[model samples]
Target: MTAPQSPIGAHVPVAGGLATGGLKYAAEIGAEAIQVFVANPRGWALPEGKPAEDAKLLARTDVPVYVHAPYLVNFGSPSEETLAKSIATVRHSLVRGRAIGARGVVVHTGSAVSQSYDAAMAQIHDHVLPLLEEIPDDGPDLLLEPMAGQGKMLCAKVQDLGPFFERLEHHPKLGVCFDTCHAFAAGHDLAAPGGVKDAMDALVATVGEGRLKLVHANDSKDVCGSAKDRHENIGAGRIGEQPFADLFRHPAVAGVPFIIETPGRAPEPHAKDITTLKSLRAD
Candidate 1:
């Protein structure tokens, strides 16, 4: 039997319909895995997924599915209403993720808009703790994606996760979705020698093993440490192609899926990126 390698793909479009467009695109791009939004990515409203659409996605055993929660979910918000909606949004995403047989649901480690980081973290412990407790054993993991170190971001670098996991009591259902563009933006200097290895080592040392569940394989549009979240194509940005090959060789990435959220119009650019990532990981 062949050993399982990390499946490389992209965040596909679900505009036409979940199964109709997303799955069709996945097939066209030869994606082994994919990520989609359960609802409008900018809205807070919780919409029930179509059972027929859900069934079609669930039946897809060859393609592993993941969900990216709405962009508005900010647990670090100073507003009570926003906090409530954030929790609810995550809950809804988890339910929808399970309905579609998703392995994980990615959410941002949001900003501390108008408050102290300490106060924000306290509120996070008070509110998000119970939310984390609500996750069932069989449910899809809630994958926390660190930001690009812009503004008052709560979590950006790998080390920032230590405090978060400590506060959440290291919930078993909690996992990470590492974004290469964000890491490069946050200044891991992945373009430098041993950068990928050092960062992976630090992640394991802090979070221990198995918390790394997914990867967003994107190139950076800005220079390292610039705190910009712009994403370019696989090898056509500040983060050259060599670092991705380094990522593939890391032990922490075993069985993790690399889903590109890069700039593209779709089928062609991402398909080309998927091919590039496959070639980098190939033996």
Candidate 2:
């Protein structure tokens, strides 16, 4: 589903506990869906969820959930230790995701630091393909969210996804988690006329249909093509608001859920964003 046409939610806090805090925050924001960190977002440690909390969240079928793998996960890393840790961390996310009945798990498509892009891509192929193969029929899809066109980053522009699918051989379970600010920062120029449509069309053409499973509804603090990942509140950034309205009208994401990763403490700002997305809907 598209923005207004689909579920609009946010990345809720899991501090109080998965169900205790995440679900409570989701309720406070009027979210129809949510994304969360199964473990620490910045670390490599994989912690098991509380069984009762897992059961509690798993029972709430109304609010669909998603898991974001830790930031340290980078399949393209040249370090063997980092590579192994990345795979294990992602696999952990997949297992945790299924335990909580999550629809998908989002992982950042990472960089090729200090090496050739081809070599880095090879590393991804060597590692990620097998990981993709491990997904059970009932398990969640692995959603790759391309980064801002920052330093050695792979898969920034929509066009960059072509090789990703080709390398994975278009695995049945692989999907995309498109991020608005990231795209804008990657030079998609989404604020211009027909820009959103152009980028979406490019996405479908690059990966084929139905691969876009999620949207990170964010605005950028930096100018277009700046390659900065800073996220601003909706309508308060350089990308403006029209592109998002156009995003809701795009057919490629017709039923995909949109989740905000914007700046906020909780509740109030996220609630306002959910309202903004609802208003952007074609009523």
lDDT tens digits, residue span 6-33, model 2: 8888998888676678888888888888
Cα lDDT over the full model 1: 0.90
* Cα deviation of 283, candidate 1, in Å: 4.5
lDDT of each: 0.90, 0.90
Per-prediction TM-score, please? 0.97, 0.96
Could you give candidate 1's per-residue lDDT for residues 142-175 as a string of tens digits?
8999999999999999999998898888989989
Candidate 1 collision pairs = none
Which residue segments of model 1 deviate by more than 4 Å? 1-3
**Candidate 2 displacement at residue 239 in angstroms:** 1.1
Q: In model 1, which range of ten residues has the least summed lDDT? A: 51-60
What candidate 2 gets wrong by more than 4 Å, as runs, is 1-4
